[model samples]
Target: MSALLRDVTSAVGDVPALLAIARKAGTDAPQPGQGRTARLWELLASVAAVDVAAARILEPHFDALAILSQAGKGPGHMDGAWGVFAAEGPGSRLQAKAGDAGILLSGSKPWCSLAPQLNRAVITAYAEGGGRAAFAVDLHHPGVTCEEPAWVARGLREIPSGTVHFSDVPAEPVGGENWYFNRPGFAWGGMGVAACWLGGAVGVARDYRESLAAGAEAGREPDQIALAALGETDRILTAALQHLARVAARIDGEAGASASDAVETGRSAWSEALRVRGTAAAAVERVLSLVSLNRGPAPLAFDEPYAKRMADLALYVRQHHGMRDDAQLGKLTLEEECPW
Candidate 1:
């Protein structure tokens, strides 16, 4: 096991320990679109390969820091674990209203993972003027409350995702109306999640290889069926990794250009992010199928680590939105001059 994996595993059930890892990463890890974008993705993938739950906790903290940096702000005095709570759904919507003490947030925000454990978060809410805006809010504010998590999923069980309610909670605006969605960092953050999925698939592939090796050590020569599955997994993972690297390079190149080119950069980055995410999600699904079909249920039933990784990966990749995302990407392709 790698050092990151070991550290994450040791921090699994301890929220403080996990937050320590996230805080350290926020200070040390390279932000997306910096010169070392590939390294950032690699770090995310490495954490996921060890523990998806740990990655789930860490990715958002890194993303929150990136969002701040992109807006020319820094964490400064505000410290500890951070998260991004921007998911919107039907029901009580979070609203940002001008208050005597700056902007205040009210109502409920959905899908806030690890909200109770985080010290702060970058959240999106309906702004007073009409459009959505992003704000950095203290999760520990007296008016803030995280609902009892209703999470029942087996994968990422350690991270509880639920709604957080605010009642005149003070907030500091991060960006202008709709800027959160319009920024290039938005697309880059999605790609980071894809990196975690890729890493989870890598962990599953590693287990499949180990199982095959163990069989061989017991005087059982590997059959062509197992060998074929292994070869296919190798192909899938290699393609995914290469695609991630290529996209990372593109992001860094775009970042080095003039500020006047931000609109074009943002558009290109969004398209590339969609393509890479779709590709990585498909690769992970194929790897899961091949490993499960060839290895059967023995490892899943008896191997604790392998079983947890498979379960975690299965649930985590669903963030890709499958066909809905494909349709969106298809529409994007239709608009491109030469999408092929």
Candidate 2:
């Protein structure tokens, strides 16, 4: 970790060191024909190796920074720590309204990660008439209050997950009415989360790798079934890596092509994100499940890193909506195939 990166990311546990390492390694410009995808994966892999929760906490910041830096549509008030809070559910939640008091946010923002730590957030609140709108709100304002953490899971305790109550907090609109979600980078950001999932899977797999390596050194051959399971896990991960590369290439091509066609660009980015997210989640789930079956509960019971990584990876992959998301991807993919 470099001194500068340490300084920049020190407030967030463990991420500064990983970011410093990535900076030292250097990455190509995020353009087509450049190895920017590899660089992204490189950073993600390093973060996952150290801590999955940290990666989860850090990725949104990376995405938010990229989103704002690439397109400075956000207001100047969002100059501090930022996150994207846009999870709308079938239950009660926040409502964004406009009145004499300026744009106001009321209700609870659920699943607001790093809610206690963030000073600013690029939030999506339900528009008054209909649809969604993104706003840059200051979390430090008196209207905003962090509630008790809502996560009871065994994984990702380091990344706080809870509801943030907004009691008519003032906010500045970001871009067009739906510009934030409409932006191409929205789904690309999802891919970044998948990248973290990929890294966490790799970290968990390291446990088996070391175990196998020790066996190899002793001139011993493991059972053929165990070896076969390992091989299958490797194949799954390899497939996911290739998918990521392809998605990155497509995104790079889009970025280099046009600045006007944001709708098409967003569609393409989301299509790629949904596709790769499905593949990557399945691959990670498979690797963890198979490895757990092959090795039994010994590691989970004894090894701290491996155990945590295993738990973390299991929860992280749930970012994908499973069959529903895959179904959406299939429909979009088939529609794209037709030359209209």
Candidate 3:
């Protein structure tokens, strides 16, 4: 494999190992009060898995390009928001803060997926200029601190939500004011996020199948009813992933761009992506529920990996801002503000 390809595979392999350690670390070690380095690493691992898989499939036709291209929405991109807000000069933006010496920050993201072990973060803040911007901050900066949160939910707690604080920690600018949200192709990452959730669901379904097979020797017969339900769930997830893959392919290929306005093209691409993500999220929920029902009380009797996978899938799927943006879909279709 080429150097880039080798690097991606190595990174992808790190996910399972990191996840194993993070899963065992319990909910308190990465305390909410801790930095999100580890959580950030988990997100990175998740992203790496998908990108590597995509690269393997697409490499036959595309050649040497990085399958997991990092646009503004890529991993570590959120910290870019810090600079966006900071450049805004001053306001109640997501990651920006103002103090006598300069803009100071002391807030936790609470839901950073790979924060527990990440060394850097693209944080957001209000700029001294009175506009929104993002900054890429080195997590090891002395003024920066991490706090892992205590509350663990049904899913994705292995990521360990927490707060990152910056006591006048200096951060460099990543983009101009409001650029983080205004940039083109910002929505692709949303779809990418959903894809990871789908993967976790697939993992659960795989384990569940194995469990069912193991039980058969004890005379457990196949339930035709549950089989159909599981099949349907699988079909939905497959369709969603297929749709997302198509979009990613198009974007990487830059298909349909030469003939159309770039903004319009990107908007359409992302809008369709959001729809697919929502569908995938729903499909995952249904699959999880169906699996639990089929397994009876046995699945819940112990905290099997699938149980944790289900929890992670549940929380991760809902992390996107897709629902609130759905209204824009109608507007896009009508070429005017949505009447609804």
Candidate 4:
């Protein structure tokens, strides 16, 4: 409907199509091949934003959800993948009664990035019956509406983020009142957000490399310096991803056998990932900024992919709640510090 919504839908819609393309591009892909990787990448990319209407609406029926549930399989299935849609953030209110034939949902949600293309949304709402409850409602319902409220930051503007509104929209209960927050991997979902930022860094770095090749005749000394800076940033991001991957594997291993420990480990990993994400983002920004500052006219040019990547990367990576906080990093060391 809205231009932003159309853009997001187009972006998300590309997931299945891209996977198909990837499969065709690579003949040696595993059984289910490109589809699997595409799904994984799509999921991981979803973490780049808090809006994941599709994930929440579709995960229950997809095999990817089960694979993602395996925390031990490594962060590949969960960390960078499995966007946590209904897990956190501001709460909403729901109306459902025994005598009433249909469920009524009325509320507003902020920062629902995937709200546009989400045919259905798994949302948390205050239940008229008692406590909080999780519900799945079709987005196209007569009373349902989504608006791209302003407040979007630079770069990640493509997310199509905005508010979702429901005025007596029909709804069905998905999980229990506490189910959304108490879910095993709830906190870990937060850490996965870092992975998306990491991907953006990778994307930027790749572009930077290409730009360097094209500008070979420009000069060598400054180009070499930029390369070195990018290398360091890559190192930092790699370390962060490695740590996150390890924790994801550990969590999965523990998940089936012990839910409690799995949750704990997941939380720990989530906190650590946040710190790593912050550091990685900072590293990338440092290099990007250095290139622009020292290169002056040459590097500041916007047509190059790497030229404007920093701004987008910075905006995208900066969306994290805890990553924005300096104290959260300390919580990773002291287990008791996690409020949730």
The best candidate by TM-score is: 1
Q: Across residues 1-340, which tens digit of lDDT does each residue of candidate 3 receive? A: 2333344435443544433333223222211102332232234324323342322122111110111122323433322111111112122224556556655555444344344455455556666577666666666778766665675675544444555556667655556666655543345434544556666666667766777677777888667876776687678767866665554544444445343422234456556656756776777778778888777775666855555555556666665545575666655757742213
Candidate 3 lDDT:
0.49
Cα lDDT computed for each candidate against the true fold: 0.86, 0.71, 0.49, 0.49
lDDT score, candidate 1: 0.86
Model 4 clashing residue pairs (backbone): 44-80, 44-81, 71-252, 72-252, 72-253
Worst 10-residue lDDT window for candidate 3 reads: 59-68
**Which candidate wins on lDDT?**
1
Q: What's each prediction's TM-score?
A: 0.94, 0.84, 0.66, 0.64
Q: What is the lDDT of residue 227 in candidate 2?
A: 89
Error of 4 at 3 (Å): 28
Give the runs in model 4 whose Cα sits over 4 Å from its true position.
1-99, 129-131, 151-154, 217-219, 223-227, 254-301, 322-340
What tens digits encode model 4's per-residue C-alpha lDDT throughout 58-151? 2322322332333223323222122123433456434444336666777776666556554444566777657766665667777877776585
Deviating ranges (above 4 Å) for candidate 3: 1-116, 254-266, 321-323, 336-340
For 1-340, candidate 2 gives per-residue lDDT tens digits of 3342344344334544434433333222231223365556556655665567767765666566566554565334425556788887666577788899788989887889877777677888888867788887888999888988867888775676788888989987776577778777787778888888988887777778787778878986678987898888788888888778666755555445444422246776677678778888888888888899987888789988778788887887887899999888879868872223
* Candidate 4, residue 210: lDDT: 58
